[model samples]
Target chain A: MSRTAIWYWAARAAFGWLILLAAQVIWLVADTAGVPLSVHVTGLVATAVVAAAHVTVMPQWRYRVHRWEATPAAVFTQSGWFRQEWRIAPVSRIQTVDSERGPLEQLFRLANVTVTTASAAGPIKVGGLDRDTAQRLVAELTANAQATAGDAT
Target chain B: MSGPGGGPLSGPAETGWRRLSPRMLLVHPVQEVVRAAPALLGLLVAGTSSGGKGHLWSAAGVGLTVLFGMLRWFTTTYRISPEQVQVRRGLLNRKVLTVPRDRVRTVDVTSHVLHRVLGLARVEVGTGTSDRRHDSRLKLDALSADEAARLRVELLHRSPAGQFPGTQAPAGQSPTAQSPTAQSPATSPVSPAAETELARMRPGWVRFGPFTMSGLVTVGVIGGFVSRLVSEGNIDLDRVGPVRETWRWFSAMSLALEIATVLLALMVFVGVASTLGYVLAYGNFRLTRHAEGTLHVTRGLLTRRATTIEERRLRGVEIDEPLLLRAVRGARLSAVTTGLRSKEGGQRGGSTLLPPAPRTEAVAVAGLVLSHTPGATGGPSPVTGPDTGPLTSPLTSPLTVPLIPHGPAALRRRFTRAFGVHAPILLALLLLWVLGEPPLWPWLTAAALLPVTALLAADRYRSLGHALTSGYLVTRWGSLVRRRVVLRCDGVIGWTVERSFFQRRAGLATLTATTAAGAQSYQVRDVDLAEALRLAAAGTPGLLDPFLEPAGSASQ
Candidate 1:
């Protein structure tokens, strides 16, 4: 994973917290019910505290946990912070390979590569890659996938 | 012979478009009439209550339905080409759907009461993509029973060049290896070749019905309805004649007698309802192998269904033994096949090879379906053994092979998990009793649950086992719904090893084999990390080697 991934994660977390805070503010202003002012203030304070701690801690934890490797035979990825997952799908069973860059990812010049198979267990994603790395990975996967035979089922 | 349906009984190699059975015209109007009846009745009642203006609406509704129904029949036509099966439909927005003959995974022929009366059936062509949308399928609504039967055989039996010649019938058993003739009798006629019956629903098998507990759902529904009536103030048990009499009689009885009576009624009700449900769903169930590399399942009482499955698409088989069913030593066997719709497709029962029956029977049928060499028996020889050479079809029953237990770490984890979940609740209850002064008997009653949870956890641990055979990776788990899944090694597409925080601390990992078949992925939970990786390597050779790091090179 690229170092910029931390910035992207922090930005996403902060943005989410901002939306939540805005909603809380709107609810506070529109609260026609007889809720105490102290209670509303206390709720806001607690939410802000938790959100700040999360924004500070989560991205680094995720960065440490995430790892990926692509070999000729299979693509292996290790991801997730709390409950980790290790996925390995053979190139022969590779149905599709896609590289995507969301707005936040583009800001950090990072990309995500998704590898899919015919299984309903769903696709494997390797996020927080430099743009060029993502492109190269996608190209390599697509070449290998096309070289193989069978309908990936 | 030219029939009223305007198509030849058995057309040339590449037939042109053909319409549905003409008798379907009668079926359509009746179906449309039934759909419009509620509104028509409401309009008629409104006409009677008002100034009779609504009567015009009622007549117009009926007329429109009849016209629409007739138009539906006129606009629909289907044709079977050498390479593809196509259906063209729609009056205003015409659409044509085509499915390659090679992609056809299953051919289901179904006939409802009306269609049965008219000697018509519906043919559904399953083009084995995981796409569950109805629009993706090619269906001919009402074809002559003979034609439907022929279409199923024609679409499924024709082997495209270079495709697998799936599971040929034992050479001598099926005397005639030729394709079925069009003149063969239409009730999905057995080919001149001997039809091998795999399993049949016996009258004795009905005893397994109550164990299925299917009637429990009905009891819940009825209970809900009764509660709803009472809650909505629609009925008063205190005022109703039979209810008040029954309540008075019940209250007069001793508490133990009352409990026994209630238990007896519930048992009888469930027994009868489950028996009826079993009879309706699986009555005359038959699993047979046709000469043409296909397994045919014919079952159902009122709405008969015949589903044909290509043996090649079959990935494996699952033997499900729910807790109650296990208690009675009953089991259900289902085929794990690709291209077959899963539960989300509303065809969950399409892959069932055997309904609830004796566990021994289920095991035997599973063995038969999976066994490549006839008369083969005993456990499969270890493929990884030295000098074993190339893998051969197992001479052993995969289902009966003893599984490798997950060891004491998994057992300890199970107990920890059970206690972890229940201890807090127990503590909370104690706190409540001490602080809030709750009833002593209630707390004591709740404490009894602790022992049951421990037993469940122990059983769950006992159930966790996995084995890597020559042909299959068999994983067994779950106590409540104990399932032994034998998945073909070749069908495995990917591998996933997941470990939660607790599992990591315990040095345990969950290995999942992802496939395109039934349930998609089956997991062997709480195994040592090294063992998991080794299993993954053995399951799909050379797929995991490059990614594996040297000892102590990567994080443990």
Candidate 2:
């Protein structure tokens, strides 16, 4: 994991807190319009505590557990914030690989790679990778998939 | 009898288009006209609002339906070739579909009351392969009954491929496998296996019905009535004549005794309903092996059903013993055959080869339908004992090996999960106490349930085990309704490895072996990561070898 990747996650947390702050403001306005003042006050306090924890600590916690590796035969993703899951899909099972980038990701020079397999586990998603690394990984997985295309159903 | 299209997969594409039954003109349009009646009424009402032209619009709707039906009947044509079955239809937008031969898994013929009256039947072809984009099941809704039966037999019949290895497969197979040409229904003799009765419903088995969620229906009915009464804000119980009379009669007894009487009455009522329902569904149940290499199950009293499964598609049998049934030493069996996808009203019942019977008989029939001789194989003397030998699925496992448990770490994980589940609820209770009024009874109940949860977790851990035998892999899982499945390793098409955060911390992973047959996928949960990989590698050799390093190193 790179130092730049930490900023990308912190930016996301910052965006989420901004929404929470907006919701608290709406609640305060509603309290002025005959809604109870206690509800607005208590909700604001709860939101403040949760938002502070999210922006300060949760990003580092997620970064610690978020691990992914690509072997010659399979791609393994061990990632989740609270309930971490390690998913394995063999290269022979890869159906399609998709690369996506948001405007925020473009600013950070990062991209996310999603590898689709036929297994019922859905798709293996790996985010917060350098754009060059993401492209190379995609090319490698595609090559591996094609080389063993006929082996799978 | 050769097919009307002559036995060509690609040739005669232009001239060999054969139409369905001519009766479709009367049958299809009547259905369409029935569907159009509601819209015609809407049109009639709309026309009346504008002017007096409602009747004219209604007539036009009927005419449109008739025209569409006639056009569909005229354009639709089907052809059966040697390698593929093709159907083409639609006048302006012509569409063609061709199903390959080897992909065809099951072909079933069903005739409703009307179809039977008209000598017509519906033929369904299932390929056992479904993609999210395309539904592979095909339904030819109208064909001559005889033609439908013939086509079903021909499509479902597969030449028995390789011998089943040991002496067991040799004793079980019909010698006719020597002649592959006999695959055709016309040439194959229908009298070889001679309908041996595999299983028939016993009247006493109906007693097991009440143990299976029947009491819940009674409770639901009573709950509905009570809620309706409360919502209506009723005051006069006497006005409800039946309740008033029952109350008057029970007034002579103590209050507790009166309540008990009512509960007893409800129990008897529910018991009778469940038993009667079971008898109606399974009274005349009969399973037989016919010479066509198919198992036929005919049952039901009011609505008789006859379901057939080709023996070649059968991967194995699964004997399910739910907790209550297990208490009485009873079990149920369902076929793990391909193409018996869980769809339609009666598919589950169709796949069930045996209902809730004594475990001894259930296992005996399982060995019978699976073509195994228990006494001859010496028996499960190693695992079960002499008398109850071949009593469970492991005996039928390709190598007949006992299961290997995932050791104590799995038990620890289960206990942790169980404790984690209870912690939040207990915390909420403490929060209630902080609110200055702790509910004592609910808190005490939750406390009492902790040991039960621990026990359930321990049992579940004990139930989790896997065995990789010669040709099959057997995995035992679940505590309440334990399933010991013997899935053929060669039938396994793929493998999936999953590890949760807690599992990863403990160096454990869940390995799932997916096959084309028998419950689709069987899992070996909470095994050491290295061991999981080795098991996957051993089950399906070189496929997983590339992904796994040699023993001692498995950080991935």
Candidate 3:
């Protein structure tokens, strides 16, 4: 898998870990307030196991991780390990492209790019890219698509 | 020094005091009186009920109304400069707005009955996107018709050359007198030289038929009644009867007199609304053709609103013929534009320019507006332009698929089957009623079946054949009123195919085409799998290809 794909899995792992941590904190507080100690411990253990399983299973699916690609004509992303579906949106039809970075994303020097088309559905976001790289990719894709369209006409 | 050869310093001196037409005070007092009416009535009712200090409260209310009216009248002021128009007003937290000459989109000037008698019109100036906040924009009420016309001309001419401002040039100037290159800032020797001699103006106003006024009033009253019913339960019919009875005994003996009074109140409200619409639609109903080929429409009665149109920004034009207006050969023309701010905040900002005009003028006006802008071709016409390909046939369009099987035999079979299923339910209901065991089953069955039957009938009605001929796609569908929507293929924004589990089993899919404006969504359903794929491919060229291709090719 590519470095970007590894980073995506890492981010997903971190999200799962955060959820587990939150649950553990809640359980510990409940235990201190005279709740059953055994129940609190069981909840913490279950959360930690689920988080570890997510980190392991997500990285093992290399085919799903490797399926996303940006071309001059379209941007395609494929996920799901067994069923493996793909979604492609032509750049010419793209209405708007926006890049956003959250606090965690900023810390990781990453940004998410959402491309909106005139289709009824919500926009598609391709996450886990460095800010500068995402900007350059968007510009290059837009220019390439416009040039191709001009040539076709 | 102030003669023809004078320098900039010798020009007219700036005035610190802003002057507004005195006729504006008429509206100010009326607005104050209307706003205060509710409060005054409430105070009177409360004081009278308590049986003390009623006269004192009434006096205080009148004094407050007068003071507020005066404050409002004094605060409103507007000033026009060579490059910008600024309106500064408000008694406490003042708002100062500056609209640059170039940014002025459309100016609408209107005059109500009162303003017409006083020979004054209200001018509303609309600036693009940024000045969308309704209250913050500039409104000049009761300006002389001539001043409003002049301002409209100045705003139109100020935009870049080669753009259409939707207005005709002055009589003396040739249609193509101003060259686009000559007005370009890069080519021109002097920065502000083009400003002079750009103001040779023309006069014309757009007028709506009498039906438009009635429709506006009816729509307003219906909307008000519906909202009031939803928010504050039903009107007190008991209270209404007593009030009418009391009025009859006190003032009039005849029932005709009571009916007349109620009718008079409704008429007054409608008359005021319609008159307000008329005033805003007053002079310079003129759409000027700007040197830039953008159409600038300025009109208004109280607060003039100006809209600027760049041909490229316009998605499409909708010509509507309501049932009432159809006989008169009159239709309302509205252009859908991007970057429109919604009246309600945060909703989709789909801006439309509505100008009620004759059907005969629609094409001519649209052609004039589109002449100078880029990608201005590809409308619903048989003739093809250089930039736009031939209009596509609706029948063959990828977006148009059969909602049901199309053979005559198939149609007849489907119809009979639908009727057969409904007939049994109706018959069963009739039988139950005769037996007198509370016939509840039939009523319940009908209540459930009515919506489902309607849905089925609608699906059957919308089973239209579509074709793509040239650059246009023509779709024919309907049960009661058959409609043929001729759309330019290039204008189609996006398309999607939706399939339910039952539909998937039946080898049918629904294809929906989304365009820029209006509520009408083009949809065709219940086609074979192969046809669905073909139609989807045509609407969105590469949608199916990614899935069809070998797994690796799409991934990388």
Interface quality of candidate 2 as DockQ: 0.13
How many clashes does each candidate structure show, in the order listed?
0, 0, 74
TM-score for predicted model 2 compared with the true structure: 0.64
Residue lDDT tens for model 3, B1-556: 1111122211122442254566556666666776666566667656766777866887798778877877775886666655567777888988888876545555656566666666666677765543345687578765666555555555555434224334432222212332232232222222223221111112321234343555356657678765555334334544678867876574754668778876776666665665455445533344553444344555554444445554444444444455334445555444544323323211211232334455556434543333323442222212233132111222332223232343343244345556678878777787778888665766677757866776666545444455544344445454433333445455555454455555544544555555543332455544444564555455445544655454333222
lDDT of 1: 0.78
Flag the better candidate by lDDT, 1 or 2. Answer: 1
Whole-model alpha-carbon lDDT for candidate 2: 0.66
lDDT of 2 by residue, B416-436 (tens): 988899978977886787786
Which parts of model 3 are misplaced by more than 4 Å? Answer: A1-98, A107-109, A114-124, A130-132, A138-153, B1-20, B79-85, B98-100, B112-117, B127-133, B136-142, B159-312, B319-333, B339-556
- TM-score of chain A by itself in each prediction: 0.91, 0.84, 0.71
Of 1 and 3, the candidate ahead on lDDT is 1
Residue B125, candidate 2: alpha-carbon lDDT: 69
lDDT of each: 0.78, 0.66, 0.51
- Please give, for residues B4-24, the per-residue lDDT of candidate 1 as tens digits: 434433344355777888888
Candidate topping TM-score: 1
The full ranking of all candidates by TM-score, starting with the best, is: 1, 2, 3
- Stretches of candidate 1 exceeding 4 Å from the true structure: A21-52, B1-17, B29-75, B88-98, B132-137, B160-194, B218-259, B344-347, B373-396, B423-445, B550-556
Worst 10 residues of 1 chain B by lDDT: B373-382
Checking candidate 1 for backbone clashes, the offending pairs are: none
lDDT of 2 at B447: 82
Error of model 3, residue B518, in angstroms: 6.8
